[model samples]
Target: MKADPQAQRRLLDLQAIDTALAQLAHRRRTLPEHAELDTLARELSALEDERVRAQVAVDDLDRDIARLERDIDQVRARKDKDQDRLTAGSGPARELEALQHELASLTRRQTELEDAELELMEQRETAQAALDQVTGRIDSTRQRRAEVEQTRERTLAEIASEEQFKTSARAPLANDLPADLVALYDKIRENSGGLAAALLRAGRCGGCRLELSATERGRIKAADPAEVVRCEDCRRIMVRTAESGL
Candidate 1:
């Protein structure tokens, strides 16, 4: 492909813009906030699981306490009925003595049930505290995640603006070059590593950092100034300048 000597030099400028755009894209993908958000998401998931377990424990304790209270009420009611019968003196002496013994047993049973209920209540309190703690941690982690998301969004917006600016700058510069030259550069860039045109400095291919063979350098030296030269090793357009040392 043939392009003006000056147009070939300006190709380097286009390459610089393309390189900057590529770097910005990489920066956008590698923003630190993305990793932080991922960490926060995992933390929240684990905390939510812990919270569910704690809630289940509290609920189980609640059911146990309710059942124990019912048992205690029934025992108290039975003891009350027996005491009333003894006070009324409505039974034989033996029967009254048996009623007294039964009353004693009911009293012991009530005490035991009351003690068990107390222990269950304590357990419930502990379980409730644990549930609250896990819930609080989840809320904190969610808040942190929101903050990180905001940071990530802000960074993305900044990168987008930079990209827009670079793209706008690239349009006119690329338009100014010959269409065939730009097409050739684009085709090579697609196959290469986003670097189609590079300076031939100190008799080296800047794209591959390889020195040109003596014959290759001689050919380029003899070629017309407007001729588009490609690196033999890497097939990148070699733009010559005074620093090329050709």
Candidate 2:
């Protein structure tokens, strides 16, 4: 594809814009906040699971305590009735003695039940503290996520604006160049690592930085100035400049 010598130079400007656009796209994908947010989200899920387990632990303890309390109430009521029967003095000696012994047993059983309830209450307290800690951590993480999301959005907006600016900057240059040349460059760049044109500086292909042979230099020198020249090794469209040493 032949183009004016000046148009070949414009390809450099287009490449610079294209390179910036590519860098911007990469920056968008690799934003640090996105990774951090994802990590926090996973941690929050784990915390939620811990909280549920802790809650279940607390619930079980509560049920145990309630059963113990009911047992204590029944024992106390039985002891009261037996004590009243002993005081009434209507039973035989053996029956009264048996009633006294039963009352003693009931007292001991109540103490045991009360001790068990107390132990379980302590366990519940500890479990509740753990639950609070997990919930607090979850809340803290969610707060941080909100903050990071805002920052990420701000970063995205800045990138979007910069992309718009670069796109606007590239529009006229791309529009001013020959359609066929731009199309060819686009097609090649798709498979050429976003670099379709290379400056032939110091008898070297700027894309690959390999020096051209004397024969290659001779051919380029003999070619028409308007004819498109390509690098022998890199296959990039070569553009000559004052510093190109062509």
TM-score of each: 0.94, 0.93
**lDDT scores of the candidates, listed in order:** 0.95, 0.92
lDDT of candidate model 2 versus the reference: 0.92
Candidate 1 structure lDDT: 0.95
In the range 1-246, model 2's lDDT, one tens digit per residue, is 799999999998999999999999999999999899999989999999998998999899899999999999999999999999999988799999999999999999999999999999999999889889988998999999999999999999999999999999999999999999899888878878999888889988888899999999999988898888988887789998877787
lDDT of 1 at 149: 92
Candidate with best lDDT? 1
Instruction: Give lDDT tens digits, candidate 1, residues 1-246.
Output: 788999999999999999999999999989999889888988988998899999999999999999999999999999999999999989799999999999999999999999999999999999999999999999888888888898899989999999999999999999999999999999999999899999999999999999999999999999999999999989999999999988
Which stretches in model 1 have alpha-carbon errors above 4 Å?
Answer: none
**Pairs of residues at least 3 apart in sequence or in different chains that clash in candidate 1:** none
Mark the regions of model 2 whose C-alpha exceeds 4 Å error after superposition.
Answer: none
